[model samples]
Target: MNSTLQPTALTEHVPQPVTRTERVQTIDLIRGFALLGILMMNIPGFGFPYTRFPLIYGTPGSTDFYTAMGIDTAFSGTMRALFSMLFGAGMLLFMAKKEDLASGHSVVDFYYRRLLWLVLFGVINAYVLLWPGDILYAYGLCGLLLYPFRKLRPAYLLIGMMLCMILPVLRNIQNTVETKQKRTTYWEAVKAEEQKKKLTDEQKKAKEEWENQLKWTKFDTKKDAEIVRKMQLGYGQVFAKLMPRNSNIESRGMYYGFWDMLGMMFLGMALLKLGFFTNKLPTSTYWLTLGLGYSIGLLLGNIQFYDQVAYILDPGAYVDTHFFSVFDLYDLRRGATAIGHASLLLLVYRSGVVPWLMKALANVGQMAFTNYLMQSIICTLIFYGYGFGYYGKLAFHQLYYVVAGVWVFQILFSAVWLRYFRFGPFEWLWRSLTYWKRQPMRLQSEPVPAAPQTALF
Candidate 1:
């Protein structure tokens, strides 16, 4: 009797992907929105070098400037934040079953395997797809740290998030101080040179540093041409050109971004535990959150956008204002905006007036992994050398045309694909590897269940 019981208990807790009936539509809907919104910010990176970012390609009050301003104010960091939060929520959902939690070892094994594969996929995305800004590697590494925090209460998770945020905030403050000092030193060096005095080593170094920073920010026709040339080269040459940038982003850049991602993940975990993602919270709560989040986010985002434009227009005049205003409360502004976006979308989902759009978005969210990779593949083909080689040809605002096209394709493709298949292509591979067995792919003649609506307030 004891031997039979042991085998039965182990079999009952075997890990598997969440089935259609088990999914939370609200989460899928929000994730789909994020996946689409992210392309707005990513388009510039796909079309131009990093140095060209935040640089308006049109005259003041032109379509280009307005587009840039709008993205900066509304979509810039919020989409990524939402995506990261959902990833955190996914961690909880993955381990939520009581039987799985009780078995412990099987769940742990599956989770780690899933993350490791993600890290590998991240590598391929960066090196092969040539997207230096890939987030999967960071997500996988940070996720490894999340397993230990899984059982912590929501209050404790929130505390942990706040603690995790402190370092990035402090770093931002330190950056502001350093930028002011560098500007002061550079001016002093110029004054000493005008007076015909020999330069001190510190002043010389400061002048060099300041000029180097300007080199990236200021428009130079020659530099732009060079960048375009490199990007429009053959695959091997382009890969070589991108290697240093990609490596740095994957290493040093990853270090700076580490705390930001981890803190957001903690917040995601906390919010999920508090029933925010599942739509279990009161309508009044979401309304309040939406109002407060947007009020703060838009206010701060506009201020930051103004400073960015000012500095871009006249670096000498606005450097101090830009540096000081932008980094301070940067995280808070983005976080608030992200929450606001999620709240607004959830409210829409609750309304039931746009059921068709919601259903399409839910399908997109379900295939987010595939859609994400697909974006990278499609963008690289459109802009990179081996494909159309349209690098640097499109203005900043024109990039959105590409974004719009991608959105339509993904939404339609996801909707149709899910009608016949159980998982998105990449998701299927991920699950199969995690479970160490082949999983079902095709849906049976029995119709897939529609995602259920939440209780109305």
Candidate 2:
């Protein structure tokens, strides 16, 4: 009866230990989610003729309201932010490992070499490859800039990131104002041209055909197949050199998506330094962050998404007058929303929700460097002429199937391939170049073996 619990009985125990490999699993999961999200966003452009911007900026609300609003904001913008953050996190990891080596030589040399190679890879992807919607070039270029800044204090890096984020917002506003003014002038000219080209019955019919051709260049595959051929073949000789109505300013990937990527990267770097990735935060804190972010981001995100849909349906006074200006507030709102989304994702990974799902995501993530490019490669084959030539044919909703198909393939391929290989093909090449030595490509050790199942992140 005097037997009070012994001190040993009261103590808690730390059970199993995690290896370096398991620690990397978290990173792989993050990358997997990011890569998948990216595919979701890019699928539209891959299947559609894509006459305009694939993102909401080009053609708002063309897709279903729910799809446009729910998917675009939640997945498109936010996922991209997550991916960029992962990239930044990876940079820190790579640098840290190098530093841990304590090699007599500086790691900066190898760092620059990797970035330079990445830039080259981006260039190849942009021009020589299929899809022009390349982010590697921007990442490579900005990452090069980040080289010096990486060594700066975390606080300074955060400040620099804020400035970069603001720059894009300001530029967007400026462009919006200027675009409205120019569009008015352009519309008037187009109307006047239509009037001047008034023609006789036969000429009028021919003119209508010409106008249609000008709009899509691939219109009327039945009777006007010849015309379509001419348009396609002559595209190089005729319009290839024709100056874009707008200057080269927007065409450059730098101005379009570079800042977005940079913002995410900086945030990632800051979070990584803050120990966000190290599972240091309380579970309650993570849940609270996710709840707040999802609520605010989803609410605002839905509003903007619906706004785009409404604008597209009627496209009346508001469409003509306001256009890119209406939801200026939402653009900034997206940043807040992205924070929430990123926070939630991090929490999931830390919490070890679904171990199997996390493992799958991590597998895909481990091969992310390969999978990212593989996406572009596979998408180009699915959409472009050199492959199936299905581009511009599939409807918005129909594109989802292609995306789903690709997702299944990627997951299956990643899991199976990883069973036999150490790193993804491209990942291995990257490591080899980074280390200046060939890396082992096969599994040198047995699987760690799965543990008791739990909820996945």
TM-score of every candidate relative to the true structure:
0.92, 0.74
Worst 10 residues of 2 by lDDT: 1-10
Give lDDT for model 2. 0.60
- TM-score: model 1 vs. ground truth: 0.92
Candidate 2 C-alpha lDDT tens digits along 1-457 = 0001111110112111112243455455666887887787878655553443223333544564346555756765766677777678667655543232234445566666777777777666655553455667667777776655566667876786787777876777886665555445455555756899544554544445434434542233453343223223332422332223112422564666677778778877786666555445566776776777778777777777666655444443443666455366543455566667656666766656766777788788777778888988888677665566666666666777888888889999999998888677886776576657676677764345223110111
Runs of candidate 2 exceeding 4 Å displacement:
1-23, 52-65, 98-104, 151-155, 179-251, 310-316, 319-331, 350-353, 445-457
Q: Pick the candidate with the highest TM-score.
A: 1
lDDT of the candidates, in the order given: 0.80, 0.60
Model 1: per-residue Cα lDDT at residue 343: 92
Q: How would you encode candidate 1's per-residue C-alpha lDDT over 1-457 as one tens digit per residue?
A: 0000001222233455655654678888889999999989888888976556545732568888888888988877888888878888888766654335444555668878889988998999999999888988888888888988988998998888887778887887787778889999999999999999999999999999989887765777777789999999998998998899889998998888888888888888889878788787888999999999999998888888877776666666666655556556777888899999999878887888898988888888988889999999999999999999988999888899999999999999999899899889988888888778777788773234322321100
* lDDT of model 2, residue 231: 27
- Candidate 1 shows a clash count of 0
Report the lDDT of model 1 for residue 403.
96
> Can you tell me which runs of candidate 1 are displaced by over 4 Å?
1-13, 51-58, 98-105, 320-323, 445-457
Residue 388 C-alpha lDDT in model 1: 100
